[model samples]
Target: MRVVILCGGESSERDVSLASGSSVARALLERGHDVVLVDPAAAVPVLAGPLRPGDVVDRIAVGKEPPSSSGRERLRSRMHAALTGGPVLELLRGAELVFLALHGGWGEDGHVQALLEMAGVRFTGAGSAACAAAWHKGRAQAVLGAAGVPVAERVLWRPAADEVPQGVKRLVAAGPVVAKPVADGSSVSVHRVDSLPQLAQLAAEVRSGEVEMLVEPFLPGREFTVAVIGDEVLPVVEIELTTPVFDYAAKYQPGAVSEVCPARIPAEFAGRMQELARRAHQALGFGSAAYSRTDFRCDPSGEPMCLETNALPGLTAGSLVPRAAAGAGWTYPDLIQRLVDLSTR
Candidate 1:
């Protein structure tokens, strides 16, 4: 099988996506599959040919610091060129399947998926519509809530005309609030605050129109994530963070958090979470998705609240989805193979 691993775009999660694509490509190559690595953010010259082990491994990043503003601009420019560049499109059309090892941004938000669909190219993970619905936090919660899934109360707002809306201010002023970019992942710009002033500052920054933000009641409890492949739910994984919030640092930095697979919780509790995760996936129209990972926060009362779902979850070794799959007795390569089969079918 010839697989084209599409990854690394202009999103804040670009570094993570590159690491994930690199890992997936390496695994596929080890299994004797022909793997071509394409980092959309890189220049066109790098978009062709089978990836060398050293090229992919050397790009693995451990830091969560997002690319600088100028860095982001350059990436966005290169990405735009790559998307329209003749060579990249030709490569996509030639692959047996395009393994979407992308996270966040246009890659995970349906843009790239839609393009692939239009070009009649098969890709792993959820469909374009499912990705669009899952990428937006506000929309995802609405769908989950309508399905009777527990979720924290949240409001989406862009500083209306450069002024923070009254409702948004009240929500932040009332008590502890979790402020985050509505469509981003890896916990970028995710903040927990109790002061109205602090929230006001965040709102002002988000008012730039480049980013839409969401404010939700800070759910203080244990965090857990479940990975769903086909109709089967993998084991639950618990996340313990040393920081006040599981920001980008805690996500990518070494030893920043502790992850326990098959989470040491009661079987009944784990079962409930797994069921809810599956429900969330289906409710969001991901029933036909190759795989997905849904996050949750257990309230102090021990009831689970759906956080969000990822249509294309991270494939890096330290990522939650891989850990959950491992607990289900599937090696990383086995998981990759399963996804490839599903996409090509």
Candidate 2:
């Protein structure tokens, strides 16, 4: 299959997206697919590239520039049009499919999916509604919890004039809070709070734009994330952070920490986590569109608490999705192809 991989956006995950695009492109080529990596954020200057792996020929570098415009919706439209062209029309002019590597914000929150749906093009990951539900931590939590899935106790708050509610203040009374954006992924806007003052301060800073702050009591047990594909858990991945916390920097940055796959958790516990992950995915209306990964902080006794779902899990060179896919005996190329197949079907 001839494929175009879309990566790099104005989002904070642009760097990660570019790396993911490059790696996926290479992997696709190795699997005997003709692939080109394109920057969805590209406009003028006609960014060029020799993307994807397995090419005996030279490759083009992927380039993307941010939208320096007015509202996010407008930018989303522009990005949507660009993504349509960036893959089917521009990037993979002769290709048969596209591999989406976008992360965060509009990219994964259904904007891109909606755009692709309009274009009648095939890409990977969850649909627009599922993407929206999963991208927003608060919404996903509510939807999943209502469906009888176990999630953490958290107050999702959008600042009223940059102030947090008294209820939110009381929730973190005992100390150890995790302040994060209710609608963000890839650990962005996620903070660990040791005190009320710190949590309040962090909340104020994160409550910008339309982004709301999610204040929840911190779970201090082992951190594990389960990757679910086609109703099965690839493996449970345990995150080991050398630092006191695993922030955005720690997730994408090299040397921050190491991930242990097939996590050293009990078999029964791992199975339970996988079941919960699948239930969360389905409860959010994902319905086998593509795949998603569920995060958790489990207590030693084996009860796993849900964090959030990445309906469009990151595929960066060192991303958790790839790690899980690898454990499932599927190489990077195989994963990309599988995503395309799953989405198309």
Candidate 3:
């Protein structure tokens, strides 16, 4: 199949998306498919290597625009053009599927999928609704709980100027609360506040009301992630961050962390993690999704508690999902093809 990988949206996770795009492009080409890698941030990037990769290859990206004019419409035009319109639309021409490596807001949050769906094009990964729902941590947790999944006790506080201090008071009792922005991903602004003073300081910084934080008790345990593809739970990967929990830095950079597959946890605990992951996927209404990674923290008791569901897991080299997929004996392109197959509906 001809696969056009759309990657590198204008989100904080833009760099991670590029890495995913590079590896995905490599794998797809190796699997004997025409793969075009497009990085929107590197819009107008020059292709230095063989244009076709001996299979079919093209490097396409959006042209750089001034930040002042960089609205969603501006982005949509570039992305839509790359996938559908534009003169160098060679990437999308005759492409059977758009395997999205783009992460964060525009990509992972369902906007890109929604656009592709409207264009009547089939792409890999979750549909618009699932992408949006799972992108928001608090809402996804609630939905998962209603579906009978065990989640950590959490309280989401949408910040407001007048009641900011009061919200801090409520969050103070959570004890070692993890305060994080509601809609952001990759732990961009996540803060672990150990006391009320820290919470008050953070609340004051939410001056513009853009950052609504979710405060919850910090679960103490080993962190592991389960990757779900179709109905198959590949394997659990135990994330051991060099510093602390898996944050943005640890997730992308090498030497900062290690992920051990078939997590060293007991069999029962691993089974529960996989089960909760499956439930989270179903509850999110991810029809024909390629894959999702569910995060969990297991206490000393060996009981797993889900943190959140990642509708769009990283695909770059050394990413958790790809590592899990490889542990299942599927190479990069094999997993990419599988994801495309699942998205075919």
Candidate 4:
């Protein structure tokens, strides 16, 4: 199969996406599948190349910070031109399957998925509607809560139009709360607030820039993530954070945190988390065989509360989905092949 792995979009997670694409390309090549890596954000769209063993580990390293937004507007203009009607579109149209190894931008937020849908191209992961639903934290939580899946209480704030919600103010006054962009990934700009002043500062910054944000009570328990593929929930992976918050640096930087697959937890607790993850994925309208990863943090009583569902979870070598899949007895190459099979089915 000829697969075009899309990655390195004009998003904060571009480095992570590139790493994932590089790893996926190598794995697909190992399985004798023709793989072309295309970064739609690139001026020229084509990044095809040969892969040697350890190329991903040796060459593609995510920086401590995302690429600067210095020339992003110009790059976005170029990306838009390249993706709409050019060699990039032709490449996508020519692929047997476009493995969406993208994260946290137009690529993962349903815009690209919609484009592919309209172009009649088959790609991995959730459909456009599902991606849109799951990409926004507040929207995803609403859908999950409505579906009877346990989720933390969240208040949506549109800083541009409305002042901070009284509910958010109350939550902050009571205890620690988390504030983050309603629609973003890689834990970018996610902050833990312990006081009203801190919350107010964050709201001000958000008001000056983005439109929407979500405020929820901070869960102070172990963090675990479950990956679901084709209705099968892989084993849970526990994230042991070395830092106070699992910020972007903690996520992609090697040795910044530890991830333990088949997390050391009671069987019943793990099973319940798996069920909640599956429920969250389906609640967002993901296809029966689609893949997703649902993150969770336990409440004070140890009950798992869904954070958000990732329609296009990171596929980096150290990403949670791949780690959980390893716990389920699948090699990295096997997991990539499984996704391809599921998407094409």
Candidate 5:
């Protein structure tokens, strides 16, 4: 089968997406599938040759900080032109499947999915509606909470508002709170506020920016993520963070954190986490064969609370979903093959 792997859009997670695309392209090539890797943000999309292991390591290595927004608008403009009608669109339409290795921004937030849907193309991962719902942390929590999935108390706040939302104020008063962009991934600009003053500072910073934010009570418990591929729920992966929060640096930088697959928790608790992960995925209206990674952080009572669902999670060497898949007895290539098979079905 011919596959077009889309990655590295004008998002904060661009570097991560590029790394994922390189890895996926190599795996698919090894599996005898024709693969073309394209970074939509490029002035002219590159249909690179078959990728070798570590071929793009230096070129696409994630930095401690996300790519600067210096020329992002120009890149987005080029991306828009290319996707609308050009080599990229033709490639997408011609491929048997378009593997979305995209992480955040317009790529993973449903815009690209919607475009593909309109063009009648088959793509891996969730549908546009599901992606849209899952991309917004506040909305996903509401959907999951309504479906009986436990979630942290959160409120959506527009930084431009004169006063903080009442719900945010209440959460802040309760305890340390987490403030993050409502629709971003990879923990970009995510912050933990221990006091109203800290929140005020964060609010001021965000107010000068454009993104809306979500505020929620921070859970001090262990962090675990469960990946659901089709009907199969992979083993839980526990994240041991060395930093105060699993921010962008801790997430992408090597040695900043540790991931333990088949987490060293009781079988019953693991099973419960798996079930909640599945519930959270389905609560966002993901298709039966769609894949997602649902994140959880334990609360004061030791019960896990759903943090968020990643519709298009990272597929880098250190990503949690692949680690969970490994615990489930699937190799990296096998996981990629499984996703291709599931998407085709």
Candidate 6:
């Protein structure tokens, strides 16, 4: 199969996406498949050959901020290349399957998916509408809640000059709340706040036009994530974090959080998590998604609450989906091959 692994969009998760694309591309190459790696943020550059594993991994460092000026200029040039019939879009045109390794912003928010669908390109992951619905936490919660899925209480807040919404007040009254961008991944800019004043302060600092704040009551119990590939649900992975929330640093920084695959929970509870993960994926109309990851938290009463669904979950070595796949007895290469095979179906 000739595959173009598209990654490194202009989202906050650019570095992570690049890492994922590299891993998937390397694995695909090992499986004897032709792979073209494209970083859309770089405007889909022309590559002479399959990316070297070492070079791909070393391309980007993990951090929260945007890329430096030189990096930004390079990306700008790349984007211009795509717009001007550059090698990126040209390569995509002749590919058998466009493997989407993109995360956050335009890549994961259904924008790129919509374009792909219009171009009649077969790609991995959910459809455009599903991506849009799943990209925003607030929207995902509403959709999932209506489908009878258990979700944590949440309040949405945009930039407002007046007063905090009543929903925000209600959420804060319950307990500490987790605040984050509705559409971003890798826990970027996520915060756990205890007071309304802190939320106000955080809200005041927001200047981005695209990000809307989502505040949900923080679940103090265990956190778990389950990955669904094709029709199978991988093992549940539990996250033990030293920090209050799985912020940007804790997520990408080594030794910041301890992860246990096939989380140390009762068999029945693990079954329940997997079931919810599947149901959540289906409820969001991601039945055709090549692969996806659903996150959940157990409330104080041990009831699982769906947090958010990811249409394009990370495929990096340290990503939760791979950990869960390992627990389910599938190698990373096996998982990548399966996903590629499923993309056509």
| Candidate with better lDDT, 3 vs 5 | 5
Q: How do the residues 1-345 of candidate 4 rate in per-residue lDDT, one tens digit apiece? A: 888888888887888999999888988877778777888888767787433333442348788887766666776776677668877898889989999998987877898889899889999988899999998888789889999999988898877765667898889887998888888889988889999888777767767665588889998888999999987899999999877678898998889999998999999999999999888888899987589999998888988898899988888888889999999999999999999989878
TM-score for model 1? 0.93
The number of clashing residue pairs in each candidate reads 0, 8, 1, 0, 0, 3
Residues 1-345, candidate 3: write the lDDT tens digits: 767777776776666776677777777777676666666545562122222446544333222221222354565566655555563354444568777888887798888778777777778888888999999888999999899988877777766655644545665765676778778766666777788777767777775655667777676678888999988998889987665455676665557787898778778877878888888888898654557888888655757788889888878767888889887888777887788778776
Candidate 6 Cα errors over 4 Å, as ranges: 47-61, 64-86, 207-210
lDDT of candidate 1 over 1-345, digit per residue (tens): 888899888888888888998789878877778878898788653553575434444448756586654577788777767766488888888888889988888888998888888888889999899999999999999999999889988877775466666767777777788888889898888989788778767666666556777888777789999999988899999998787677888888878899999899999999999999989989988865468899998766878899899988888888888889899999998988888877666
Q: List model 6 lDDT by residue over 244-309, tens digit each.
A: 887777877778999999899999999988888888888888875457899888788979899899
- Candidate 2 Cα RMSD after full superposition onto the native fold (Å): 3.8
Model 4 deviation from native, Cα RMSD in Å: 2.1
Candidate number with the higher TM-score (3 or 5): 5
Q: Give Cα-based local distance difference scores for all models.
A: 0.83, 0.71, 0.73, 0.85, 0.87, 0.80
Q: Write the per-residue lDDT of candidate 5 for residues 15-118, one digit (tens) a residue.
A: 89998897788778767787778888886587584444344423357889988867779878877877788778988999899999999988889998998898
The superposed Cα distance between candidate 4 and the true structure at residue 177, in angstroms, equals 0.4
Can you write out model 2's per-residue Cα lDDT over 1-345, one digit (the tens) per residue?
Answer: 767777766566666666777677677777777666666565541233443443553333322322232444544555666656543365544557767777777778888788777767677777788888787777788888898778777887776455667767776776677887777666765777787678657656644556677888777777888887765568888998876556767786666788988788788888888888888878887776578888888644656788888876777657888888887788887887777767667
The TM-score of predicted model 2 comes to 0.86
Q: Pick the candidate with the highest lDDT.
A: 5
| Cα RMSD for candidates in order | 2.1, 3.8, 4.3, 2.1, 1.9, 2.9
Query: Which candidate number would show the highest TM-score if scored against the true structure?
Result: 5
Minimum summed lDDT over a 10-residue window in model 5 is located at 50-59
Instruction: Show model 1 residue runs off by greater than 4 Å.
Output: 45-48, 51-59, 71-74, 160-162
